[model samples]
Target: MYAVFKRELMGLLNSLMAYITIGVFLLATGLLLWFFPDTSILEYGYAELTGFFSLAPFLFMFLIPAITMRSFAEERREGTYVLLAIRPVTDWQIILAKYFACLVLVVFALIPTLIYYYTIYQLGLPQGNIDGGAVTGSYIGLLLLGSAFVAVGIFTSSLSKNQVVAFALSVFICFIAYSGFDAVSQLFVLSYFETVFLSLSVNEHYQSISRGVLDTRDLIYFITFVALFLIATKAVTGGRKW
Candidate 1:
């Protein structure tokens, strides 16, 4: 598992794809938060980084899948997955290694965005006047959301050998998991079941956690779904052995 983790991480770090993905995420977010007139902080006349947190989720939906699309898909396509199976790594460990590898890259991409926080901290009216607690909570929620997405991407990657197909499927699954429940809730007027379905969606949990309140149920939602996807990926790989 360690070998798998190291190799996967190294592979990404050494490749242009990792740099490109990270660059695109940062550049795109920066443009939206600091450059785009309507969404820019200069235009908002506030020190808060609310726009960044609000916009990041949408960008991560595509960025994560692009990063993880090759985890298992390329391996199987190139006939390396069978080689991986013959090694001593257990199924879950293998899936987890790939999951963590992709997640670490996601984290790396996020680290650079801390500059935005620092800039906002200094630019506040009273200096460091920003909503520190809310910002911290939002960052944590975003990281958790990204982790769940990594699991979804890995699961989709394990489903097929075509990278494009894997990318599309992962994005679709992530979108549904992240927002589809809320979308569905709007179709029905029943408040009771609508709330239930919204609770099942990732956005509901993410938004709850982002409000500077750490609800046990919200954390559990993310962990449970991430585990579900990872387990599903393990099952897929175990049966295929490819």
Candidate 2:
């Protein structure tokens, strides 16, 4: 798993995908938070990243899929999956190694945002009037949300050999998982099942946790969502050999 993890990470860095993802995330966040004078968070009265966090998940709709589209699709396209299959590694390990590699990239992409915290801190009206607990909670929520999206992307990537198809499917799945249920629940036809559907939606839990409440139910929802997709990927890959 470690070897696979390292290899995957090295590949991302070698191709500069990791750098590009992080750079884009930072550039977008920076522009939203500081650069654009009219829409900048600094112009707003809120000290916390209410604007930043609210905008990020939507941006990640594209960015996370872009980062994860190649995870297994590229392997299958290059015919390296067979080589991986002949190795001693279990499918679980292979899935996890890829998942962890993507997670590492997500964390790497997020770490640079700490600078935004510092900037906000220094610029706060009372020298850090920001809610520390709320910021921490939001960051945790963001990580969980990203993890679930990564798992979804990986599963979608595993379903296709073409990276473009994988990317498109990933984005569609991510967007739907994140917001589809919320949209569906609003429709009159689904009104009877509205409560049930909303509960199943990713955005519901994300919004709950984003409020800085740290609800265990919301966290469990994210963990289970990620695990479910990972398991589905494993089942799909296993079926390929059978």
Candidate 3:
């Protein structure tokens, strides 16, 4: 698993895809937080990244899929799935190794954002009046959200041999999972079910946790969501042998 993880990580660095994804993330966030005049982070006097955090999950609708689209799709396209199938590793190991590698890449991409925190710290009126709890909570929420998206991307990548299709499907699925429930909640026909629907929406739970509240229900929801997708991916891969 570690070998597979290292190989996958190294492969990402060798391609332009990783660079482009990271660059785009930084560029988009930087522009919103620093460059843009009206809604810039500086203009809001937000020592934390509430604005940036709010925009990240939406931006990741494209970025996470771009990073994960080729995970297994490219392998299958290259006719290497058969070769990988015969390896000593179990199918779950292979899937998880690849998933972990993608998660590592996502985490690495987020590391640079810490500089924004430091910058805000230095610029704050009290030289650090920032809400540390809120910032920490936001970062945790981002990781949970990104992990769920990564799992969704991996499952979609496992379903097809074409990377482009994988990317599109992954993005669509992530967007739906992230926001579909809230949309359902707004339907007049589902008025009675609004509470349940809203409870299921990823954005709802993310917002709760991002406020630094640390709700157990929200944490459980994210954990369950990730596990469900990972298990689904395992089942899909296992079916290949039958």
- Assess each prediction's global lDDT (C-alpha) against the native: 0.91, 0.87, 0.89
Tens digit of per-residue lDDT, candidate 3, span 124-237? 888997888989999999999999999999999989999999999999999888899889888845466998888889999999988988999999999999899989999887
How do the residues 103-217 of candidate 2 rate in per-residue lDDT, one tens digit apiece?
Answer: 8888888888888888888888899978888788889889999999999989998999998999899899888988999898888454668988898898899888888899889
lDDT of 1 by residue, 68-165 (tens): 99999999999988888898889988888999999999999988999999999999889998998999999999999999999999999999999999
Backbone clashes per model, in order? 0, 0, 0
Give the residue spans of candidate 1 off by over 4 A: none
Q: What ranges in model 2 sit over 4 Å off?
A: 188-192
Error of 1 at 177 (Å): 1.3
Q: Estimate candidate 3's alpha-carbon lDDT, on a 0 to 1 scale.
A: 0.89
Worst 10 residues of 3 by lDDT: 183-192
In candidate 3, how many Å is residue 127 off? 1.0
RMSD of each: 1.0, 1.7, 1.6
